[model samples]
Target: MASIAIAQTQQAQATTSAPSAAAAAAPAMQLEPTSVIVLDSGGGSIKAGWAHDSQPTIMGNCITRPRSARRTFVGNELDQWGDLSGLYYGYPTQKGFIVNWELQNKIWDHVLSSSVLEVNNFAETSLVLTEPLFNFPAIQSAMREVAFEEHGFQSLLHTTAPELSAYQQRVDSPSAQEAQVVVDSGFSSTYVVPFVQGQMLPSCATRIDVGGKVLTNYLKDVLSYRQINLMEETHVVNEMKEKACYVATDLQHELEKAKQRPSSNTISVDYVLPDYTTIMKGFVRAPVARTGPANMSSDEQLVKLNNERFSVPELLFHPSDVGIKQTGIPELIGLVVESLEEAAQYYAYQNVVLTGGNARFSGFQARM
Candidate 1:
């Protein structure tokens, strides 16, 4: 929370400094991004911001929950921003895209009602709202209607966040004028978008619905299967993944090392189980007495078990092992390149820029 607060403060400071800096340096500056908006409607987050900035000003979703001031629907109401109630809160997107209309409207309403968006401040602003590629016409029409009729904005524009990231990269690298591949590993899915001279290659661009959520769920399942019993409790399992889990470069070799005897290789984790007793963590089908003498084989089994938990998440890269036919990041990148015109593949590679939450996965960029 402190880190978030600090970052927000820095962003506020930057926002204030930009206008003054621009005014002081006006003579040298020609055309600037000046007034632009960018929106990313990924599964887990809905981020809106000015284009020249690296971060978002407004980030929320269509999901609602019981908040402090309200019984339900905290996300829709603006009055409860600082005093959000302690109830269920969530975004409208389920897998990666918007499915619920009421929730979407509520989120949009809350955004418009924000103090930053007050009528006196930004009435004639240029707006940009992102949508999924090949978005349904009905959703598009509804979006347009809401922005024009409800918000009363003068200018409106639409584009994909991944495309904009690609544009930013292209602008930075002028030589990337050929076919390009963009891998947007966002919250909902990893999208492989191929482009030829800035035009989308609709047929070759594919979306795979495996991502962070899948990784978390997979970790939960592995821990549960090892008798850790995380089904009723996800907090510790989530913590273990966030704090300890890592993808191994070589699975078989790592497994062999993890199978070693527990003298120097294994360490115990103290967990207060449902019974509220501090017990050393190990791989056991049933909980053993913490007060009892330590056993050697049990410790070895525990180490192997933890290794399996760590390795299982690697299945996302090669889903064929689990019978899912979706392509992984590197394969998808090649596919995107292939889908473009023959001359454009190299250009696309040079301009390929990755964005979205999933891009932060360890080794994701290297693998791509």
Candidate 2:
């Protein structure tokens, strides 16, 4: 997911450094480093920073109440927590829309507080916040109200994540200046959003209910059924998915290889789960060349993983595998592009940018 997000920025950088005809037409003017805060609040995390100056401060976007820790982790505070096992999660957003202002306000306070950003006041700076595609009108205005009425920001620009991504790509290159398609695989849901010349084409936007959180939950269920019950260990499960999962370029071929001789198959790996006593983190080790049953270290527990690794990530491409009955990511993206005029379709295809956490999976770019 981090790789894909960085790729999008790099794509923009290449164009920004050497402006093409379309990009040259409207050059970006330099502004004060702290003039505008480009805030991207996704279902899974928040990415916020001063535009054109620094990288965004990233933090988990949800609230957690851990049984062991017995303390509430609001937003980025979870990063400081030690044990995350058997934690109850509280989401401020439902289906990609912010529904709980009270809880979310707590996070915004932390983000904007003097101890964090050192911003004494927001009235002097403009706030640019990214909202989900096809946002509810009430939620949309409510965000603006909070920024102005609650936070006292001088100005507010409420835009969608896909639009910001498209605009960023467009400002650097002429490729994204026309109709461009953006696929944001976020925590709450994946969205197929179209933008024309930096403006969102709401008519061409679509949503897929599957997302990172869903995939993590699904993996937890499958692993519990097939191996161990990791249903309540969300933090550990999420970490496992991030480290072990990858989208398969050829699903059938990979599945077949996993069934073949275990010694030579490339689809197999051994994940060492943390004991939380001697070892604090889990990691995958390179396959050992063995002639018989695998050997385990006395002090460590190793879980042999095969198809489950790719199969979980494959849910993004084939939601039907889990009975969601939706078109795959690429097919859905193609459909959205085909809906545009023939001329725009070419531009849309050429400038399709993938953003959000799910895009970081290995072979994700190749599969799409």
Q: Please, what are the lDDT tens digits per residue for candidate 1 over residues 177-219?
A: 4655667765566777776665566678887777655666677
List residue ranges in candidate 2 displaced over 4 A: 1-31, 287-296
Of the candidates shown, which would achieve the greatest TM-score relative to the real structure? 2
lDDT of 1: 0.53
Question: What TM-score does structure 1 among the candidates reach?
Answer: 0.70
Q: Cα miss at 150, model 1 (Å)?
A: 1.4
Winning candidate number (lDDT)? 2
Candidate 2 residue pairs that clash: 1-360
- Write down the TM-score of every candidate: 0.70, 0.89
